[model samples]
Target: MLAWYTAVVYAVAGAGVLADAGWWPTAALVAASSGLVLKAVWFDPWLTVGVLLDVGVITAVACSWPASVY
Candidate 1:
């Protein structure tokens, strides 16, 4: 049950990112989804921290504005 919910959350977050939605909202959703999944999967503390950090970095990169100055 928890796993299913977590998957759904991740799917929703992925869809949001693919949709090119706003950065903050997408980052927040992804972080929340990852957290839920990590907890549900009972991942090791260090592994979970790593996963979270990766997600945060990815989200930051994705949200970063391009260097092109129109």
Candidate 2:
């Protein structure tokens, strides 16, 4: 039951990202990544690293692009 609930939450969050509703998608992704970091601290440090990498890539892309293009 809990797994089902979590999946539903994640699905809604993914839909929000697809809809391009501004910062909510980024915020949700960050929050979920934080949770993973906490839960997998011992065996899965890569999860946190991946999250940081994602942030870096997004930041680089955003910086490399001009807002006026939007």
Candidate 3:
């Protein structure tokens, strides 16, 4: 399901972070964004925490990125 796919993507992103791969941020951002869309399509009260986590991930990635890329 979408949740499983998102979890796998997040695991890959986490590994990329540990490995210091240049694409980690992009992967994380994509996964987080997809997760947000998924939640929006299938809204649930219990999923609010997940929405917050996705937003946090997006914010972290954006903040840590170099200004030159923007």
Best by the TM-score measure: 3
lDDT of 2 at 58: 51
lDDT of 1 by residue, 1-70 (tens): 6556656765665666667655435544555656656665787666776566546745655665232310
Q: Count the backbone clashes (under 3 Å) in each candidate.
A: 0, 0, 0
Which of candidates 2 and 3 is the stronger one according to lDDT? 3
Residue 67 of model 3, lDDT score: 46
Tens-digit lDDT track for model 2 on 1-70? 4335545655665566567555544555554555454445544655667556546635644564335322
TM-scores of all predicted structures? 0.42, 0.36, 0.84
For each candidate in turn, give its C-alpha RMSD to the true structure in angstroms: 5.3, 5.4, 3.5
Give the best candidate by lDDT.
3
**Candidate 1 regions with alpha-carbon error over 4 angstroms:** 23-70
Error of 2 at 43 (Å): 11
Reference-based lDDT, residue 5, model 2:
51
True-structure Cα RMSD, model 3: 3.5
Clashes of 1: 0
Q: Which ten residues in a row have the lowest lDDT in candidate 1?
A: 61-70
